[model samples]
Target: MTAAPAFPPLVEAYLADLEHALAASEPRERAETLAAVREHAAESLALHGSDDAGARRVLDELGPVDAIAAASTPAAPAAAGAPAAPAATPAADVWLVVLAVASLALFVVPLVAAAAVIWAVVRLRAGVGNRRVQTLALAVGTVSLVGAAALYVSHVLAG
Candidate 1:
């Protein structure tokens, strides 16, 4: 197996600082940000030739770790005693609900409904959507899937 590319000391130190700076971010967001930044640094190193000078250049282009962390982090609540803001419903959640509802048409168009059910299940598993919406999608999608399967089995047995 090929060895993993090694970063210069400067790049490694920058990554360490970045990790510390991102400590307050959501775990998923932190991991994603770090991974993307690491990949970019690797690409930059490859382009510039892996060395302290190249790493310095890459870090310069990236700016300070604190600035990067600030850009990635969500804004703080306006007041210390104020309630945290509710997360907005993601677009994917909206689509999941649409697909789950559309699954009701399974009796008339099994393929479309099947696709909808599949999409709903995938989105629900990702756990990225609002809880209430995800629950609705899962419930509706399950019912449709079961109904479609029953209808298919009955038709097959009848013929």
Candidate 2:
């Protein structure tokens, strides 16, 4: 493979500073920012001439490393009354509700009810889902499982 083009010492120092500033960012974010900046520097240096003056001009356009790092970091929650992004519910939580309802409808089958109960318990332990929905699902699933067990016992006794 061809060797990478050598950057001037000034450009190298700026990149080092930027990398240090980004140390606390997510790995993917840090990598992406570094790569983008490196490419921009290369392109700018080629166009402006690869000298100390050109490196300074490119770094100036990119702004201070601290500023870039702060921008890369996630923002704090919006102040009260500011529009907030909606919390995303996981799909498994949605499925938990559906399975709970299905367990109620199919409570005659012990296996279906048992499956729903297991899923509800697992999700509850994982600390996910809407609070009310999780409670309802667990309650419904447990009741349905109990009913199915009772029905199974009765059938065995009778037959």
Candidate 3:
């Protein structure tokens, strides 16, 4: 078997930093991670034929000390008995827009449009409608109702 390769001071310093960063990890875990990193460095050195510059290249590929340490740490496990989260419900904006459009029937039939607008408001307050689109619907509905009322009053005055 061939003797192990000796890395330059820079590579040693990088490894030292990596070890320091991983100190909080379990001993066996830390050793395993460090060993892998060393193995990679050794292989890179062999390919480069003992060139010290290869150490920097190998360590660079291994990534920064902090990143390696962070990667080695796992997230906390969830409680065994907890229920999984439910899927999200679809937004109600489409129906709200439909109602808003229906409300514009105020020009043709004020009573129908009024009912549609009332229903839209109820949905908005109930949190069923999407806020952004519902606001635009409210504007359209209000304009249609107002225009209808104005036309009705004008017709009566002209007649």
- The candidate scoring highest on lDDT is 2
Candidate 2 residue runs with Cα over 4 Å from true position: 1-76, 82-86, 157-159
Instruction: Score each candidate by Cα lDDT.
Output: 0.82, 0.84, 0.74
All candidates: CA RMSD (Å): 8.6, 11.2, 13.4
Per-residue CA lDDT of candidate 2, range 1-159, in tens? 966567889899999999999888877889999999998988999999899899889988889989999989653454777888877777877888888889889998767777777887777787767766777788888999898888889989999
Candidate with the larger TM-score of 1 and 3: 1
Give stretches of model 3 more than 4 Å off.
Answer: 1-4, 74-159
Q: How accurate is candidate 2 locally (lDDT)?
A: 0.84
Better TM-score candidate (1, 2): 1
* CA shift of 3, model 2, Å: 50
lDDT of 3 by residue, 5-124 (tens): 577777888889998998877678899999888888888877865556777677778888988898776433356777767544335666656766876764766765565567667767
Clashing pairs in 3: none
Better of 2 and 3 by TM-score: 2
